[model samples]
Target: MKHINLLLLLIVTTITIVLLWQGAQTREKESQLLEVISRHSKASDPSKSSDLTRNSAPGGAARPSAAAFEPDHFLTELNSLLDSAGTDSRTVQRAMRMFLFDNKGKLASASPKALKEACNKIEADWATDAKSFVWLELVSEIVKSDPAWAIRNIDRFLMTIAKEQPMEKMLHYLGKNGRLGDPAWSPEYAAELEKWFDTAEADGRLKGMDEEAAGMRFDLNISLGNLLGAVEQLTHLPEDSLSTRLEDLAASSSAPSGQRGLVEAVAAAVPATDFQDFTRALSQHAGFDSARELLARAELTAERHDLAAAGIAAADIGPQTAARADWLITTLRDKDAGAVTGFAAAWTQAAHKDTAAWLTSLPAGDARDAAVAGFAPAIARLDGATAAKWGLTLENPSLRTSVMDHVYREWHQQEPEAAAEYFGR
Candidate 1:
């Protein structure tokens, strides 16, 4: 029993000694870490060292010694702390926070070189497992002081850990609607940004930023007065939101120095392919009367004339859409009644089934009859027998006879016997 008790006592003594040694090591490590942080804090503000020295002089208040701001020395100690084994995340985060941010999480006025070096070191060592919020915040702050440098370096930070917050911040800083007190946006700057967006999109950093990119492009084109380009961007946006943006354009365009009357002018100037987008948006955004007024006031070349008529025809034909169509047919009948034929051709070329459905939905009367009259000619161009049969379905007897007679005359010119036989039947 005596031997067993002694053996137990020995075991306890060994364990106690080991624990004391470990406690002492922990305290020593903690002390070293605190000293490093103290030095870093002092370096962030060089005035602290001067204040200490001044206070230590004659007739000065007594003060503690402060280490001078030494980028090289401080970095060495910082790297050493990070290199030590068993360093926890809390320790690393606290250390980096002290090095990069003040009490309010704002960046300190550290030299750019030191800031960059320290950030690079932290990102290299500590960012292997997770993205660093502290690092991203630092970049956001940097964007204010040197946007160009931030813009150039941001992609590097995002290579492995792409983040949307910082990317958007960088873009917003350069966009025209930037925060108040920013430098006025210049067209040259916009042009440069256009190139950057193009490359960033190609590289995939701009993935999922379609709406934002479109908005920026719209603003850039506005600054450059590329009306067609600006209007083109609107097509990518939500249909419901187009009215407000169009209103913005109209408000500005009403000014004497604004692009007033140019909307109509550009309609005739640009190619049909380009002007189609403008007319589509215009027809959908404005009510029927508004669309009619705008189109009526404009001087459209032949290329766009039919497209404009088609845009109205394809738009939502409520009372408003119906009114616009009637007004176009009645008002322009003497001058360009052939526009309706073109409208029918364009609509049918894309979706004949939809054209048939639209014609069916029209109220029974002159409107439906006139629309059918327009469609008959275009359909005859496709299949004259089919068009003559379609004209026979019309309710107005005289109108039906007239339309069928016209189809008969055209068909006779192509297939005389077939036309006579079909009409006779």
Candidate 2:
């Protein structure tokens, strides 16, 4: 009887532990389900909350699944919403956004044939102006999935543009839906797009739209991720319109690396005479890190390095600027200090008399302070007394001290007597 009791107790304990483990697993799954629902719900409608809760298992029924969020269920629901009379277009859009955000992975899984079929069905069912947006929205998502198909079926999108819509509106649709700026794009896709644009122009789709066509080409080349090709296209635009467009491009998020490609392209293409204005525009729009990146990547020929140095000298290097500028300085100093020194030397060379005169004429301000900080050490090594005198002119006292200390050390190493005499005064 005692042996029987011990066996029964062991069985009961084992059953209890199994039940507890299953209960913990259920709770964890429920938590995950709630999180996914909550996230998609917020994206769908900020005002509404998800009603999806963990249903109690009856007779050991299977757990809740995300089958409702899958494409088959969503497509059926989308069609139902579309068929329902008096359904606000916004409702459909919100559903689509939520579905796309949650199941964006579907882009990879959904076969191109399925996508093409969906696009065909949507085109066949084109019934009302209200439902027109559905075609474009799906096309945008499709472009994200299969860009080559999107390019081949480009006219399906172009035809949707109303004749009354302004060229800007058409451009916006192309930009947003074409996914032209998506970084995942390949060079071959870009070349194909370039050919398509050329064909469009030759076939009269872009007739009498030279300026707009050029703008689109610039954007496409930028999308190509080829800095030189994008820069080369800039020359095709009207001179008067180029600066405004370049500024817009510099400020645009449409480039692969955001503004970095446009920055590099423009830096390479700009005439040495206009670098200061270009740098300032970049500083105002993109920030100093872009300028540093441009400098870092430049081939640094005599003309190029001197022009870039002058531009960097004139632009804002304030505490309010990106902290990455300091990081860049420290990093460059650690890895390749000679490059910075060589750049400063080239800028101060007699061949760059105009650049030197411009620097000299600048009043004491952030530009001057930056210039002093950048060039003082090189000047110290070249002419110790002159560099020591130049470092004292900086407006930021801490910056002044820091630059002066560096300058003095170099100067002292070069000419200790001159450095001592200069500081003693």
Candidate 3:
């Protein structure tokens, strides 16, 4: 009987040890499960209670399961929790990004109307979250399939949102990738876009916009490359306001010389009869020096176009027939000295006298020297004796030498013996 009792005690001890081991194992598993639940709860809802530890399982189930951790369901629950009252903007945005990432494939495959509805829901839910850009993210996705709808709603979104962040984002997207010039643009859509710009400008939002946005607006609307569109926009602005804005735009250091394009576009848009007045205003607003440069470029472009169409030689084009007096002077100064001289001599006698007077009256500078050199060869070819007398009046020694060399070459070419005899003196 004692032996039997000993065996029974051994069996009882074995059973006790087994029960303890299993209990420890179950406790360890519970600890691990609680860790994961704690992490997920904190991530999805920071305000969740420490009492969750008593439940011993995640998702309020008897045990953790694969379904409890599915990313889509997890994100959906997290989003629902985040949408609750008192949730901060940072948390909402984080949750929104996660939701988007998890559902991106499904969203991409959805119909445009469905995609738009999802975006509207996000906007409605997060409208109070000042720092949230989830709506923009949604719009970006929506734009890939339905750009027109996205664009039409952008202004509406801007109107509903208090912050400039959304507007800036929309502008940035529009400016990037030539979205403004999208081939899908319709007349109604174009009008809507124009109206938006008008409102933005009137509200001073355009003025306060970032430099890139401002540049894109001007580039899309008022650039000379888009002459018709540019002119239409310009005509809508008051004259004084337009002049002021143009001056400011022209002063940008990034494109100082490029302002000439703006000037030319404006000039082309206006009636020819009003061009003088327009130029005068431009000179007053942009400064005389800048105005002159712009006008010169404009005249050069027009003349070149005219010449090309008329099949006229540039060399044969005379100052008298040119649109601007300065064009002729500039052309003469640019040509080779010999050509200039020949052209001056070949001019009508009245023109030759006018050219001579103009050259003499020029201030003593490289320009004056170039003009003197240009006229010397022609004068010598026409009458070497007279050119020799005029050579004495040259102030720069190098210029004087250049004039004499040209005169000698021309005179030699025309009458070698007489040129030799004249130089021999």
List lDDT for all candidates, in order.
0.57, 0.55, 0.51
Ranking by TM-score: 2, 1, 3
How far in Å is the alpha carbon of 402 misplaced in model 3? 20
- Lowest lDDT sum, 10 consecutive residues, model 2, at 54-63
C-alpha lDDT of candidate 2 relative to the true structure: 0.55
Off by over 4 Å in 3: 1-95, 127-132, 163-174, 177-192, 202-214, 221-225, 228-263, 266-425
Instruction: Summarize candidate 3's per-residue lDDT along 1-425 as a digit string, tens digits.
Output: 99999999999999999999989976765554445445555565455455544333234432222122232343344444454413444434444453444334455455666656666565655535532354555565566665567776766766666446766766765653543344443344444455666677787776556454544444454332343354445554545445544443333323445555655565555443233334444444555445545554654344332221121111233453233323434543232223223234433232545556666666665445555665566677677766666665676797798788778887887788988898884
Instruction: Evaluate residue 3 in candidate 3 and report its C-alpha lDDT on the 0 to 100 scale.
Output: 100
Number of backbone-clashing residue pairs for each candidate, in the order shown: 0, 0, 0
- Put down candidate 1 lDDT per residue, 134-244, tens digits, no spaces: 455545455555555555665555544555475576566555655311244455555656667778878787666677777777677666666556666775666555555
Pairs of colliding residues, candidate 3:
none
* Full candidate order by lDDT, most accurate first: 1, 2, 3
TM-score of 2: 0.43
**TM-score per candidate, in order?**
0.38, 0.43, 0.36
- The stretch of ten residues in a row with the least summed lDDT in candidate 1 is 98-107
Position 216, candidate 1: lDDT: 76
